[model samples]
Target: MSRKIAWIAAGGLAATLTACPARTPSLPNTPAPIHVPPGCEKNQTGEYHHAENPAFLYFGEDDGGTLTLGVARAREGLEGPGDAGTTVNIVLQRTPDGFVGETRSTTFTPSGTACPVRFPTEATACDDKGLTLRSVAATSIDENCRPAPTGPNPQWKEQRLVRGAPDAGASDAG
Candidate 1:
């Protein structure tokens, strides 16, 4: 009887060991390398090209009531226009913060007139006529700025504009 009991205990122990799950080896912690897109490096002037995403233009009436336009990004390292092909007139102003203020106006050389403009941030408001502008409030500015690694020759893309409905289209008559 004692021998049978010992055999049963040994079988139970073996079964328990078999039921246990295998352990996986732990991997060492290592930081991943940062990815910088094409044509996003800094220029000779020490300004980096703005990244494409999270980057957007801002337009509104300035304090003097004149039309105001600017482009902003959430991250640093953006200096000049990366890929936005439109020729823009830019002005830099001093700000209390270390960063400088930038304003831009598109040169509609082809049409000889300023084309209606829109930015990612102002898309909703300008949806009506396909033309909208937004104010540069403290909150709006704060939400758009992001930190990024500075680089030279940062690449930029041109923003394409869609024309409004053609005037020639007429309503159908039954």
Candidate 2:
């Protein structure tokens, strides 16, 4: 009787283990879809070339529907050693008319002095052809990293970017 009871208990334990398999770890929630305005429905994910310069802008969607624009400029070593080029990161949130956000710029000088500045920006008239972006802020920090009073004119001038091919280095699978 004791042996039969032991066998029965072992069989029940095996059945329970088989019935409830180990649960896999849960994945993170997916990001919510970005709500774009009527005219802004066109795909804006690509690389843009400056109208007159060799600079390029890469526009892509980040997590949570935020748009990230990366600015890459053509710099030659002739500028001298330790002369790091300027880096600009622009984050834009979708709005009714277009995208509104700020532009953060950091210029690295040969002397290793870093001047970081920010400006309020707006992007409008985004289409399959190009995008119009303007900096609405009037104040900008100077090279000495002091808040300099800008004149009536805006600090960062407006720029028009013409659409170009998507960057080949970026993975499309994502």
Candidate 3:
């Protein structure tokens, strides 16, 4: 009887071990953050807001040798001829390095004027990740209904806009 009891107990232990599979390590609650390039910070990746201005910048996939970006502002309202909201399509051609490029801004005003803005000495940099873009209040109008950099360049000028949150994956505007 004792031997039979021992045998049954051993078999039950084996069965119990086999009945329950090994436990796996629990997964984390949130996914890991995205990756970013070195020396790069975040720019206008998604929705951006300051005190009085709201802006958006979208960087699309590279098409051939050109890069496309959608720049939009929805807060400023003009009286004569413009949408309360406006979007500027930006097309850029890269130089040798990935840092420098030529940008052409094309926008149609509310007055039905198609304007292309370019300068002889134009340079586009995503340097330091457009740290000052958030400071812009969108005071871009003078007496004339034109785009004006009324604020300081370093404080209000648009620069490299990224595609992720500033803390998570602040990457290049690819």
Candidate 4:
């Protein structure tokens, strides 16, 4: 019967379509690979110092493409007497411009006040020289003693940090 033939044709078309493999959709654009700079390479970890600002950046392990670090921005001459430095914790991802990431900074005031503040930070690796660190902070402090999220737009600050030498006065005993 023609009705049976029509059904058979439809069934055959369905079978053929299911038998064909589906094509995968390709990405329109692929991101370029990240460039790792010297002193920030895998397994290269240590403390770097910013002489002018009296800050310190301690680099942790560069495992799995992520770099964790601690930043200590000394406030010896920048803040009131008895004020310590500002410390920032950063987790940076490898980027085309070295490493970029967010930071949480805590400024220690002379009155023992400290609070977490969010900000953006960047770092660039150099050829056996040091790292160029760029960071931004709100100029004002909130009532809660935290760094305010207001100021000259970004207030970007930069510093060049070199490898710190071992302290001669430090004792080996724990």
CA lDDT scores, all candidates in order: 0.32, 0.65, 0.42, 0.63
Ranking of predictions according to lDDT: 2, 4, 3, 1
* Model 1, C-alpha of 85: deviation from truth (Å): 21
**Runs with alpha carbons beyond 4 Å of true place in candidate 3:** 1-54, 74-87, 97-100, 106-114, 119-160, 165-174
Residue 70 alpha-carbon offset, candidate 1, angstroms = 9.6
Per-residue lDDT of model 3, residues 1-174, tens digit only: 999999999999999999999999998798444332333223323332222222443444444444455544432343542333444444444434432333345455566666655322112434333322212323333334466656444323444354433333332231
Candidate 3: lDDT of 123? 26
> Which ten-residue region of model 4 has the weakest summed lDDT?
165-174
**7-97, model 1: which lDDT tens digit per residue?**
9999999999999988889889865542222211111122122222223333233332122333333223546654345544233221222
Instruction: State every prediction's TM-score relative to the real structure.
Output: 0.24, 0.55, 0.32, 0.58
Off by over 4 Å in 1: 28-31, 35-45, 48-174
Q: What TM-score should be assigned to candidate 1?
A: 0.24
Measured with C-alpha atoms, the lDDT of residue 77 in candidate 2 is 40
Superposed by TM-score, candidate 1 places the C-alpha of residue 37 at a distance from the truth, in angstroms, of: 6.8
Which scores higher on TM-score, 1 or 3?
3
Q: Give the TM-score of candidate 4.
A: 0.58
Per-residue error for 59 in candidate 2, Å, reads 4.4
Off by over 4 Å in 4: 1-32, 35-43, 53-59, 72-87, 96-98, 108-113, 144-150, 166-174
